[model samples]
Target: MESRRGQGSLEYLFMIAAALVIVLIVIRVLSGVSSNTPNQQVILYADPENFPTFNTSDNYFVYQTTVTKIGDDLYNVTFKAIAKRDLSHVKIRATLMCNKKPVYVGDQYLTVTDEVENLPKGWYISRYWSPIRRDEFPCEVVLYVWVG
Candidate 1:
């Protein structure tokens, strides 16, 4: 009789522990669901307002410039370069400006053709600048393109 009573009490405690675990799991799942709603979206990048959306030059055109935050103090700048004329080599120097002051400058050198000849007109290339450490937003980009 004493052994039977002890066994029943053990079973009761096991059931209560199981119930507590299930309740915790349900609460955690429900909390996760609420946190993932559309209103809680995260901003992956910074879109500067004063930056030029489309910029043109004699030898090339720069457009679709984007600044993305990669780390706490590092940011990346990317832009599309379209060749206005045929060229063998293209060099792009992009300067990130904040409040009329230069924050970071990056250079991208692209070989458009294998041979030492012109790549062709209207060819496009994407340039991703090295990461910079600038936390300010609403910045601008100054482009300098060289073709050979």
Candidate 2:
């Protein structure tokens, strides 16, 4: 007995296969898809604003504030910050953010001594404050570090 698919059925099957291939191709083209590997990131910081959005994506620390002082008519914010890379050649700078502006407190150079450079290879100034202003009393000082 000779068994063969009818012409109509064979044509229908071929048509269905062609339609499936065409649909796949159209989907691929429309999606504009190409294989991309995900990048690995280290979560050095975890905060709401630090969640990869406002970041410039350059592995830099986002400027943050910690309300170090909440006085009667002032708020002193001390921001704890460090350089991203080890042995970072940095110039220490202080800024007091009171009314949405940065006021520089002069630049301080790092003088690495035997006790500082040899034992701990880190540069940090714990308390960097601006000089007292004559026109201000009980003023708020938002301490921040500027990496250069």
Candidate 3:
């Protein structure tokens, strides 16, 4: 009877140890998933009220530039442009900067069908990968826009 009781207690100890190991494994997996998720923020140099209207003229106006993180190190950037005067063609150029360093640059050509009078035309940039560290979060993002 004494030997049986000792064996039963030993079994219970083994079961408890197994449960603790399973719990630890679960915690580690959850923490890994959370760490890989991207956290993002955008900073604008110009005033919000005057934004998307940084400059305007009888020819063209550039505005509404934004950068957003879509996934781990992935981003989606967009901006707006408006035509003030009739033109045969137009070109839009964008430069994305992080921590005062250029990370991406792109350009697009616009046709007459792409815009309307007094209406803003939208441009999008997708899947931009940024190589930055967690400590650099909420990093300053600057977008430079030009139309020609």
Once fitted onto the true fold, the runs of candidate 3 whose alpha carbons sit more than 4 angstroms away are 1-59, 72-74, 100-148
How are the candidates ranked when ordered by TM-score, highest leading? 1, 3, 2
lDDT of 3 by residue, 29-126 (tens): 99877544322122332222233123322234433444445566544434444444443333333334343332343222111113222333433222
lDDT by residue (65-127, candidate 1, tens digit) is 667667776666666656566767555454554432334542222112112235567766665
- For each candidate, what TM-score against the reference? 0.38, 0.29, 0.30
* Model 3 Cα RMSD, 1 decimal: 19.9
Model 2 TM-score on a 0 to 1 scale = 0.29
> Could you report the Cα RMSD, in angstroms, for every candidate shown?
19.1, 14.7, 19.9
lDDT of each: 0.51, 0.35, 0.38
Query: Which of candidates 1 and 3 is the stronger one according to TM-score?
Result: 1
- Misplaced by over 4 Å in model 1 are 1-47, 50-52, 62-64, 67-76, 99-118, 129-135
Clashes of each: 0, 0, 2
Give the per-residue lDDT of model 2 (tens digit) for 1-148: 9999667988989999999999999998865542121122212221122221112122333333333223443333343333345533333233343322323333341111111221122333333333323223222323222222
| lDDT assessment of candidate 3 | 0.38
